[model samples]
Target chain A: MLTPLLLHVSILGLAAASALGLFATRRESPSMLGSARILAIVATLLVLALQLRRGMEFGGLPLVSRFDTLLMVAVLIVGAALSIDLTRGLSVLMIGALPVALAPLLFAAAIGMPDEHPERNLMHPAVGVHVFLTLGAYAVFGVAFVASILYLIEHRQLKARTGPSLLGMMPSLETSYRLTLRALAAGLVLLTAGIVLGYLYGRQVLSGASWRLDAKVWLTTVSWIFYVIVFGMSFVPAFKGRRTALASVACFVIVMATSWVASFWSHFHRYP
Target chain B: MELSVVGVNHRGAPVEVREQLSFEEARLPEALAELRRATGAAEAVILSTCNRVELYTVRAEGAAGAMESSHWLALQRGVPDSAIASVLYRHAGLDVIRHLFRVAGGLDAMVLGETQIIAQVKEAYRVAKDSGHADRVFNVLFQRALRVAKQIHTTTAIGAGGASVPAVAARLAGKVFQNLAQKRVMIVGAGETGEFTLAAFHERGTLDPLVVNRTVEHAERLIARFGGRAVGLDRLAGTLPEADVVITCLGSSEFCVTPDMVETAVRARRGEPIVFIDIAVPRNVHPGVNRIENIYLFDIDDLQGIVAQNISEREHELARCEPLIDSEARRALQELGEADVHEVVGRLRDAQHAMADEELRKTWPKLGALSPDQRQEIEYLLKRVTNKILHGPTTAIKEAARDGSTPVNFLEIVTKLFRIK
Candidate 1:
């Protein structure tokens, strides 16, 4: 009962904050967007705390249940975006990205909670850590995707000579371009650690589940390869700005698809 | 207390007349002393600026004529009284207060809503307070006027728009770029208007502008103030691609920045936008150059139109501010009235009550045997006695608050004699 109520409240608050942020994009007033950013952060923190408490009650992590995992992913997305906003003062960017974070929570709120989440069985601790790391990596990429969009918008305004509407609100194109690279590297490292941990746990716990036979294995590997390509290209001077922004947008989309389709089909991810 | 102003301003006098009447800072003390000696005014403040010279004074007699200030100005500056009298303007009481508010609010300035006059007023008031030329009357008046100036800008849109061409140009630049601190400017001419616009931009960020002129020496001299490099007109083409903003002002009849020049710069820039402001008389940049991709060009007339629209906006905002100023001024006058009632006399009354309360507290334990009702009756008696004793003086003070001419300082003498803490 408490989980459903908290989930609903978090969804509503996140939705309001995102809407206010959209309105504030045109306004130069910091107070207007500041209010929205604070509300979203508070909502995100409250939901994360509730989810952690639920994890402790269940004797393990919240990633055991599908609804629980989705809600926690929403919290992680908002939490990472809030941290970036605090450091860079990018309330506008937070506003742009928060709606994407809110989607999972809204979906969870509508479905409510199951009496017993079979995914909540803490059969293996290593798999729990792998799930947490992967979710965190996905959250980081969501924020990076927003920063990429900002870079593209600024680039477009400068290209079209449209007298600086979006340009005035966003950070410089160089700043956004650099942020995309930093976020991509950070996301790649976490995803790699999660995959390595997943493989180790699979060998110890699974009965004859090989990378060739499991859908989740090859999909995760493909996503990892794409990240490596992007991470390597960032070092090349010519492939720096527009190419990086495009790669960030494209890579995140592929990663999202891989997570959903691979996890749905993987027998190894289900509890025994 | 009486309020009055004797001044010569831009509206009433020519530049030559104002120059003759102006007093330097070194000569102000002697000028003030002579004016006081001649007018026999109780308190005075002299405000001097490039556009106006004014003397504000308070006299107890309430019969000070404008001729007294006029004669004093003529005698001290060694000018004929008849010559100074021709362009003199005078105000008294409420009119003087209104004039000061208007002056501080920039309604009476040569440039509508200019900020410099308020600073000048503050400086004048500071000098008067430091030199012992102003007392309580002038202090309250000038301070309230300053507050009114602040309130006018904040609560209304009177200061929401730029009233000058330079200010409009700077605002336009702010709209063009997100972070102006990182942007570089290239100035193609050394005209005064361009310099004014550059000065306005200085308030936003420190800009080391690249200045180009027909004469290399002239550009060097102008760019020295900003710690920037000076380039010759021949180098303008090469420098165009590097500059994020370009302002051109040439005295020649021919266009200096043609389509070919802009096309070359744009090709080098690839797609980065550049702002061009041509403030010259015959127009330094060709009008057709605005058709170029990634180039924004504005002529003098475009800036003037922005200025006109800005002025219209400020005028609409002024309508909103006038009522606020009127109500605020009225409230200030009422508060000043109440302050007259409180200041020294209220402090003495407080001290008297504190002394009485102490005496009663020392004897409070002795009244323990008395019933609560009996003790309350005694306390009531004490309060009535204190009120009766102060009734005459407090009534007189309240009267003085309403009528400024009433002798409010008699309570000052009472406070001093009693050695009230």
Candidate 2:
């Protein structure tokens, strides 16, 4: 009962924060942005508390349920947004990040908390680390996705000479570009480590099973390769500002699709 | 005391008239002393800038005081009364408060929302205070005005964007580069526009710029004024890769920076971002270069468009600031008025205490010699009665003063009733 209540409260709080963030973006009010940040912090804490309760109920970390994974992703997204340096531009970034963070929680609310625990092997330490690293990468990429969107908006505004309007509240093109590149790099590194760990664990434990044929493995590999190409294209002269932003956005979409497909179709990696 | 301002600004007079009446910074102390002496102003501050010359004074005579200060100003500056009279404007009482707030808030600036006026006002007040010309009223007024200006700028987008072409160029470059000081600047021409643009970047801490001009001598002259190395146009291609920002103002028919040149530079820089600001007629940098990755190009038209937009944004913010300033000005005036009310209240309380002591002295002779405890009880009773008697009037006076509902001469009535001299 307490876990469900916490989840609802966290969802409502994040939704309110996102609404306030959007209002702040339009009005350019520093106080309003500050309030939104505070609200997001509180909501993030509630989500974390809910996860802790579920972990206690399951006798270990709650990494098996779809609801748990989504909650973890939300926490990571909000955590990254909160932990970043609070510049004037960070307010605008939060305007994007809060909604992205809220989405996973809303999805988790729809799925509801699980009544049953997963197979024992799913709670293995290796699996737990792999899930955490992969989710951390997802959250980082999510930030990069928002940064890319802002970059595209700011880039277009500058190109069109629209002046400092609502879109002008966003960070500069250079800032947005740098943020996208850095977040992507960080996400790629985590994703690589998670994939390596997962590969090794599968080799050691599922030696007799055809784990290579799993749909999750294929989708995750494809997403990783796409991100690698996107990161590489950031260096090429032809794909710097607009093109790189576009590619990063597309890469995140692929990432989301991979996660969606993996959850429903993966033979062994499915969330119970 | 009443507050007053008498002045000529860009709106009221031309530069010739303003400069004639302007006071030099070095002569401010002498000028302030003389003005106070001549006009009998209790407090005075003179704010002189390129766009305006204002004399802020506190005196009992109100408008007459402002008028006398203006006359004194004209006579001191050797200007004919008739010549200065038509251009002179005056504000007294609460209007003086509003006007000063507007001035300090940059609403009265030549460029709307410009920030320099606040600094100038601060200096003017600093001079007055340091020279013993500013007293209680002027100190409170000027300090409140400065805080109001800061509040306006912080809460509203009044000073949002740059207003000039060079400023906009620097702003654009700032958007591209995180730290401009570390970036190398290359000026493509020796024209005045290029010099201004280079100076804008120089102010942003880009000290050494590589000057590429048709004449090495012309480039050297610019480099001499602003620290940098000079090179002829032939070195443009050789030096192109080294600069992080390139400002072009050469009046050439063809593009001085072509796409090929920029493409090669991009390759050499390893995908680092570069900004190109083209501020020349016929355009110096090639338009095609903007298409190249890592190249951000903005021409004169773009800068002007952004400037116009910024100006419009400031104007929109002015509407929002009007109500805020109006309320703040009114609140400040009431608060300052309350200070007078507080003094009157204190005098009233003191008068009651004195009257109570006098009554006790008169009654002591009529009564027989009493014990110390009995006298002490009587004294305590009298003190409580005095407080009870004053509480009703005190609350009424404070409430009336707070809400601006106090009757005219209400304090005067209280003072006369109590004989609180």
Candidate 3:
């Protein structure tokens, strides 16, 4: 069993990993990036194992609180994405996305534990499914956001007739753009399906609370509409370069904004 | 030992002159056989590439052997003895070995450190070996050359990256499309440069390409080979928008790809970036095309820029490789020197054993130990003593052999002091 001391060490390890990745990108060194990849992957595994152990102690999966579920999903996505990137020579993606993942975990630690114990709510399946799709979509967009940033950097360098400076370590502009498009397209589909499922579960499965719009729901819908336009424009044969990349990046930002609303709404709705 | 090479390469000779002097693959065997018939060389290997042809050989000891071989080679080539003599190069002993090693290492290639010539040299050796023409000396020499080439490849960074224009262009394409197999490439000419670039594109499994040339038949030939569609030059503008990469190497006097053409293509492309490489000296693509957004234009100057960088990198690696080559050459020379000692020692041991056996026969009967077995043991002891006595002198004889001058004093001392035939 990992003591509290070991868990603290794991957090430190995560910080070290983040620092290494950032340094590697700044230095434009593959050897440094390769080392950072190893450190990040190890920290992720240790953190996941600790989360799993803590999760089992509190009670089984469904009985655990929604925040725990959110935390678990975030850990799983970061772990899986980093592992995949390591194998595919996409280590630089972690440099762009992992800091965002680290932010929530660090914030939760600072805020201390929940006052109310998690109850075994009957609407468990609906909540679990909704959170799963939403977080999964976030992870996919995380990848898309990284790719878009790379595209912009590469496009600028090419325009300026200068070399890639530090950004050359990222995948090529064409590669980045294509990957962004694929991830964004997939995320849009998942988001649409997830929104529909949430409405259905609220009406039929849970108590027949009349369907009402919340800040979180409205913002999510708005982001979904933005993505739909982005996806629609991709089919136009002429608009296949920097414009497509910028559109995907814009959609990811909206997606990130929706998450902030969800977090804010979850805090108010639960605490109130 | 002296070594000299007299030959004109791509730098020194015109294409027409090189073409006239170059030996075709079909005629190489006949040439080799005639060379052997004329020169009376026990062993020879001919290294013939597009850029240069060289003959390497080992001559037996004596001035007569060198003169006869040189005369024979001049006659077989159907040139006058003086003309042939003037153009031909010769190297003897260690210098000859060093020359072969350098040639195999790609130091002698038109593009320094290019790998294609190594294979060409290997094939040349193979052809010679197959013709039952390579003797023990040539066999060892060629094998050493091949080994040295391989050593240079693994130990040095000389061959890293794509060295040629086509290869570099294709590599750039790979940076654009993560998987080139999914991309479409277009070739705008059927010239030699275009064909080379086509080969590079074809190597990437993801690219599907089309060929367009002024001559429809030539374009069709390229398209047929690569499974790409063919079109006449008239349809180049129609084809441009569909391609992700457009490479032009036409020999035309006028611009085949103009600013207006690129402007229309980019608009039609819907802001998709199209990579263009114009690798012709006369400039087949217009300079104004580069101003169009999302149209990346790289002309001959850009490729030359890369080549210059690559050459300098190779030169850096070449500095690292030179010491290795020198060490190997020095080691080979040392081995050859040691072999001379071994030969002399072997002869001395044989002479001593024979003399001991003769003396034993005469003295055995006189020694009254009686039994043949007992007598045989004494003879063996005598032979061992003779061998022990001869060992030091035999070693000295070998040391003398390496100086390459008169060892008459050393030979006289050994004969007079030992008093043996």
Q: Give the top-scoring candidate (DockQ).
A: 2
By summed lDDT, the worst window of 10 consecutive residues in model 3 chain B runs over B1-10
Per-model C-alpha lDDT, please?
A: 0.75, 0.87, 0.68
TM-score of chain A of each: 0.92, 0.96, 0.82
Q: Tell me how far the alpha carbon of residue A114 in candidate 2 is from the true structure, in angstroms, after superposition.
A: 3.0
Per-residue error for B147 in candidate 3, Å, reads 6.1
Residue-level lDDT of model 3, residues B12-77, one tens digit each, is 655654454566777777777776666555555667678776766554333144445445544544
State the displacement of the C-alpha of residue B341, model 3, in Å, after optimal TM-score superposition.
8.8
Those runs of model 3 whose alpha carbons end farther than 4 Å from true positions after fitting are A1-140, A149-176, A185-229, A249-265, A268-272, B1-8, B11-21, B27-43, B58-64, B67-73, B80-102, B133-239, B242-273, B278-294, B324-421
Q: How well does candidate 2 score on lDDT at residue A78? A: 84
The sequence of per-residue lDDT tens digits that candidate 3 reaches over residues A115-211 is 5655555337676677567667767777777778777777665544332241245676676777788788878877877888777776765553433
Query: Which residue runs does candidate 1 get wrong by more than 4 Å?
Result: A15-34, A63-91, A94-104, A118-272, B3-119, B134-183, B198-208, B214-218, B224-227, B241-244, B250-328, B343-386, B389-421
Query: For model 2, how does the per-residue alpha-carbon lDDT over A129-182 read when each residue is reduced to its tens digit?
Result: 999999999999998999999888877666555665623467777788889999
lDDT rank order: 2, 1, 3
Question: Model 3 misses residue A223 by how many Å?
Answer: 5.7
Interface RMSD of each: 6.6, 2.7, 4.4
Question: Per-residue lDDT for A186-230 in model 1, tens only?
Answer: 888899999888888767766664644677777778888988898
Report per-candidate DockQ: 0.09, 0.46, 0.23
